[model samples]
Each structure stands twice: as structure tokens, then as C-alpha cells.
Target: MSVILESKSSRVCINEKGAEVCSFVLKETNLEYIWQADETYWARHAPVLFPFVGKLKGDSYTYNNESYTMNQHGFARDMVFIVEHQEKDSATFLLKSSEETLKNYPFHFELRLIYRLVDNDLTIAYQVETQSEEMYFGIGGHPAFNIPLVKGTNFNDYYLHFAPSKSRFLLPLEGAFINLAEKTLAQTNTSIQVERRIFEKDALVLETKGENAFSILSDVTNHGVVVSYDNLPYVGIWSPFPKEAPFVCIEPWAGIADTTDATGKIEDKKGMNLIHPGDVFERSYKISIK
Candidate 1:
């Protein structure tokens, strides 16, 4: 099932299965900004990554001296979320850990995703609460939007412009695991043009230090999208390989994937968080369709 939310300038659809945003349409232009989730290139729209983000070494992790198995991005994306509350332009979906989840994650916790629509913008807030004495996990977003948002524009015409920052390099991923081999794309922060081959090595995980927001713009088209990831520690840009896929994902990650030489321990995984009992972790990111 899916829920619909509308604002003066936009309309959105959220699937109850994963609380994933399936659609985001601009009312003024009648254009869809979110991906259509075609199985040919990719099979998902916007999936929430929880408990874990990216791949685990050997597809398993050791927790409390015991091993648990989990795939890339974890199981939250495949679980149903209950509607906690809803209004005309906003909704909240909740997911609590179960025996099924504990078997793989071994932690009691609650995950909530709140969607709010205001004019041409949508904000997604993620909140996690720990019920166990200690919980180790990661959380992130995987939202894909249509590239060349305006018709008649090629994918390569669009580029990502970041806010000013110090020199940085991207940690390239090999089969979704950090390659450890790095390269500096920009010395003083600049726009990185979107090309067909940029994603040949998988998503480029931009180093998070002093980086926050970016705008997806085109040289000829006036239409684009701006993403603001205020507190996120990392951002990922990706698309379907070798197909010149029509959509692009601008991800805001509070945690990241395993490194090439990861030790397979949940606690030692880079970007994983540890939450004390009775504590809450809250973060959010915003998207504006222009």
C-alpha cells in the first residue's frame, strides 16, 4: 500500500512496505523528480538503509562474540512500516525490531521515518531509539531522482555543485567495498560533471569533512534539484552501470559500507554508531525540486 501527500507545489507517494518515497512530482511543471524504479536497470525507488549501510565483510559480522548474517543495506528496506500518524501533507512510519530482526542484528530498537512536504521541498527525518543496553548500527538514505529533470536535456548536461570546502578526495568502492585506493577529484571544491563513466567503479563516497549540501544542475536546463544534508557524514552519487541509466541517486549517509580489508566485527565497522540504552539518534536531509 502507498500513502499520498500533497503541497501547493508538489505531490509525493510513499510505499508502506519500506516507507520508501516512490514518487515526487512538481505541480507546476508536471514533471516527476523521483526515479520510476524500473527493473531493467535497478529494481528499487528510494530504499532506507538501516542497522547497516552498504556491504558487510564476508556478508556477516561478529557481535558479542557471535556471528550474524546481513546483506548490503540490511533488512529494513524489505520490511513493512506501520503508519504512526498522518496529516494532509505529512506522515510518519514506524518499524520496531522483532525476533526476526534480532536473529541477524541482535538488538532491540525502533526506527521511524517522517516525511513532510512543504511547497516544492520534502524533508525526510530518521529517528532511531535503542532498547538494549548497547546497540551498534548504521542508517542512511538511498533516494534516486530523475536525471535531466527537464525534457530534451542529456544526462551528461547535469552536474553536482557542492558548497565551498577544503580539498578532498573520494574513497572509491570496488564491488561496494571501499577500495582504499583514493584520488582527489577537486582541490578546492568545484562542480563535478555527471558523465557516463563516473560510476564505472561504483558510487564515489565523498569524504564528509566540511561538506554538507549540493545542487544537481544543468548547463542548459533551468530545472534541477538541491539536496541539503546538514548533519550527514557522507554523500554518495551513483547510477546503474554501463547503461546510461536515466536516474541518479544522491545519498546522505550517517554510516557507510565495509572497507576492502574489514575485520568483520560490527563494532569496528567504519561509520557504525553505538547507542546507549534509552537513547535516541535523530538526523535528516532535504530535497528541493526546482
Candidate 2:
């Protein structure tokens, strides 16, 4: 099932399966900013990553000395979410822990995704609450936008412009695991031209010390998107590997993939967030059409 939200300038469609944003269209120019899931390259629009981000060390982790298995990016994205509330330009979807989720995640929790549209910007907020003594998890946003943005431009014509920052580093991946040896992606410089080879190794998981914003811009056209986040510690830029897909994903991550030498313990996982009993965790990011 899907829900629609509209503003004076834009129309957005969200699927209930993942609470994923399937389409974001600017009304003025009839331009669709979100990627249409074309399976030849990638078949997802904007998927919500929860309980885990990226890949596990061995696609399994131990909790209390008992081994449990989970796939890359966790199970939330494939689960059905109930429409909890809705208004003209905003809606909330809720996912409560189920028997199916507990077999792997082992938690009694509720996850909520709240989306709001204001003018040309779409804000997505994530909330998690758990009843267990403590919950360890990761969460993130994987939103892929059309690269060309405008009809006349090509994928290579677009580049990513970062907000001014002191330094930025990328945690390079060895296959699906993180390589602790960080590489300097930029130093005061703020722009990287889009290219196919940059993602040859996979998503560039970035850590920027001072800024949490970036944009997709093209030299040939004025159409683009600005992505900004709050409380997200990592940012990932990715596209389908070796496929030259027509979309680019700007991800905001609260956690990251397991390290190559990960201990196989969920509690010891790098970048995992913990919430104490009766507490709630929240994070958010925004996409603005320009």
C-alpha cells in the first residue's frame, strides 16, 4: 500500500512496506526528484535502515552468547508498517516488534517513521523505543535521487557539494566490512564530481567533523537537491556498482557497518546506538528540491 502527501510545490508517495519514499515530484516543473526503482540497476527508491546499517561481519551476531542472524541493512525495510496518523502534508508510520523480528533482533520495540512536507523540502524523522533493559542498534536513511535532475544533463554533469568543513574522511570498505584505516576524502575542499569508478569499491562511508549537509548539483542545469541531517554521525554516498545507474544515494547514518575484525558481538559493534529501558532514540534528515 502507499500513501500520498502533497504541498503547493511538490507531491510525494510513500510505500507502506518500508515506509519508503517512492516518488518526490516537484509540481512546478513536473520533475521527479526521487529515483524510480528500475530493477536493471537498483530496485529501491528510499529505504529506511533500522536496527542495523550496512553489512554484518558474517551476516550474524551474538547476543548473550547466543548467535542470531540478520541480513545487510536489517529486516525493517522489508516489513510492513501501519499508517498510524496522517494529515494533509504529513504522516506517520509505525512498526512494532513482532515474533518474526524477535527471532533475530531479540527486542521489544516500536519504530516510527514520520514524514512531513513543507514547500519544497521533505523531512523524515525516525523514532525508536524499546522495553528491554537496553537495546543496541543502528539506523539510517538511503535516499536515491535522480542524477541528471534536468532533462538535458547527463549523470557525469552532476557533482556533490559539501557544506564547509575542516576535514572529511571515508571509511573504506573491504568487501562488505569496514576498513579501519581511514582515507582522507577531502581537506577544506567541498566538491566531488560524479563518476562511475568512485563507487567501484562500494559506497563511500564518510565522516565529516563539523558539517552534516551536502547537495547534488549540475553544471549544466539549475535543478538539484540539498540533503541535511541532524544527529546523524555518518554520511554515505553511493550508486549501483559498475552499473552506471541513473541515480545517486545520499545517506545519513546513525551507525555503520561492522569492522573487518569485528568481535561478532552485537554489543561491541562499532557505531551502534544504545537506548536504556523506557528511553527513546531519535534522528532525522531532510531533502530539499532546488
Evaluated with lDDT, which candidate comes out highest?
2
Off by over 4 Å in 2: 183-188, 209-211
Root-mean-square deviation of every model: 1.5, 1.2
lDDT of 2 by residue, 1-290 (tens): 99999999999999999999999999989999999999998899999998899999779999999999999999989999999999989999999998899999898999999999999999999999999888999999999999888887899999988886446777888898888875556543657899999899999888755447789998798899999975778988999889979999999999999998899999899999999887879888899997
Q: What tens-digit string does per-residue lDDT give for candidate 1 at 82-130?
A: 9999998999999999989989989999999999999988999999998
Question: How much is 80 displaced in model 2, in angstroms?
Answer: 0.7
Query: Estimated TM-score per prediction?
Result: 0.96, 0.97
Error of 2 at 187 (Å): 4.3
Pairs clashing within candidate 1: none
Model 2: number of clashes? Answer: 0
Model 1 error, position 212 (Å):
1.6
